[model samples]
Target: MKYLLLLLPVFLFAKFASNESCKSCHPIIYEEFQKARHSHASLFKDPIHKAAWLISPDYKKKKYTCAKCHTPTDEKLLASFDYKQTIMPDINSTAQKDGVACAYCHRIKSIENNETQNINIISKKEHVYFGNLKDTIKNPFHKTANNKRFQNGNVCIGCHSHYRNKYGTNICSTNEHNELDSANCVSCHMPKVAGTPSNMKKRKQHAYHGFAGIHNDITMLSRYISVEILRGIDRFFIAINNLSPHALTLHPMRVMQLQVSVIRDKNVTNFKSKNFVRILGVDNNMTTPWKAKEIVKNTSIKGNEKRVSTYMYKLKKGDIVNIRIGYYLLSKKVAKSLGLQNNKKVNRFILLKQKVFIIKPNSFAPLQQ
Candidate 1:
């Protein structure tokens, strides 16, 4: 029957197909995907995820509800949780290693909204995958359908939007408005690079698969952010413009910092650095993800926000002002608790943007390069 024939390919792919299967046809994309954060999203592969999971409440019960987003390819792992059963994740399985596989993402038909979090609705038509191509190209492996969500990048909302703990406290949220009209996640994260989507077609450029983010390709993503300095008589304003659709930071663990220094006569005068973070807490104090009940403090820059900070330092002519904005994957306090205090990568202050401005005589603005 036609139905059985359609189901046959799905059954085969579900059991046999891995990312390796796509290598022969889409070698370039497959290589790029291997370097993506989605590929190493699992706890076993991602150190931060593993550390966080080990401390989470679900770890003791052997309930991996996070697998729904972290190891999405592991249907068995997800099914166990759905059945209200506790099962250890198979550490060696391809699903565990693959994390968010290409097949899993391409099959997403819709996103089901819920208070706890949004859910990804996989296509029942299994063999058919969705894409944003203007014209449908026949593929030997499966069928392709044009999806408006994929084209506009709304498809990413299923995982990247927000998360709230069982204690009714919002832990992490990228958007306060919960609307896509303000920003496009796809255009910023998956910008077109010099390559074709697949070997089956020839094109000048294709959507990058590395999934630019704080971990993977920070430089590429930093292009969306802008920094400006406005000078005054006794004070100067430094403004950070977040051009992205979501907050400057998506995770509560992450922290952004602004450092300013003035160089005069070869002597460096460092001003106090300001850190922007969203601190979750229980009662009135900072707490972990599981115990958090409310936001204690939030100084993070919002989506499409131009945040300005006024510095009262007086500037002299010919004084070189250095302004730098950077971030850390985790705050020093959180990193210490997570046993990542010694981690160079986590503790490293990743500079996003830097500017050197020299105060000019008689001119209100500095001579910036």
Candidate 2:
């Protein structure tokens, strides 16, 4: 039996193709993927990964732990470093530069379990590719196998779900899988388009390769949250509902802030701010990239959670109030410390819903101004 197994065709041992090879058959997907965050997963370009590598006290001695997700294809570079130094892979290599390349994802045979960081990918060097569709067709490039996990969203659980640090503490908690019933990652991230997956197949709805996420657009945020403002005699109430199945600001470094500002006579008066921050690190330092000790201040709304905060201010007639919301990938202080250019402004923040309530001696009503 062992001798017979060795007699298999040489294509069984064929090396996996590069992203370029995948482009020949999947040009549309390749183009969209280039715009995705996954394509820019290189350590040199990713600010978070660079900052972590620069600040980690154990980076020089231990293996960089980030490689398991960022650049899994650079196995040769990973082995060159000490087993402890597993996080940082060789960023100098071509395969590493591709980030999560096309071959890396399609070649995955199976995921052993759903543990976020402990995803066990069964890979083979052969030309066999796996997909959600079951209709096997003869293709010139490679063979295809059906994987139901791809359809159910379990395939993405390993990377998108909660993950623990070396200290056995939850560092990255993204429970998107548990939030929606029967909804898969592809539904939102890779929206379906009326087209075939490959040129060799008939026209059918296929998932887009954009892989939309936090970096995509504000429209995505609006889909998961709703905001309303209620006015009282001396205080204003801001109500936020987390319509998402997953926690708001799932990543440790990500933050969402709700701010209330008062304007009088076309000038700003009082400003109050509340932060929904995910705290991580050894000493509850929000700047720490990974190995979170605990959640220091998690004011963020959980799955299907609703929160209302009241701000009190002495309001006179003709007073205009502006309520705004901002979302950030990292605090300005942390971003400055890391010398990142993208952190100066609240780029991701958008005005969800704002209202101006005029206070009269006897009554208060919302005004257009």
* Best prediction by lDDT: 1
Candidate 1 residue pairs in clash (backbone atoms < 3 Å):
none
lDDT of 1 by residue, 1-369 (tens): 999998884565365257777788777789999889999999888888888998898888767888888888786777678767666777877888888888888888888777777888888776687887767568889888966667667787788767888887777786434676335677878888897777888877878889877777778876777777778889888888888767776699999999999899999999899999999997779899889988988898987898988889877789888988888999988998899898887688888878888877766763333
Give the top-scoring candidate (TM-score).
1
lDDT score of residue 194 within candidate 1: 91
Q: lDDT by residue for model 2 over 279-344, one digit each (tens)?
A: 765665654645556666677778778788887766666776666665777666656656664754
Return the TM-score for each candidate structure: 0.92, 0.77
Q: Candidate 1: where are CA atoms >4 Å away? A: 1-16, 365-369
lDDT of 2: 0.65
What is the lDDT, from 0 to 100, of the residue 81 in candidate 2?
Answer: 51
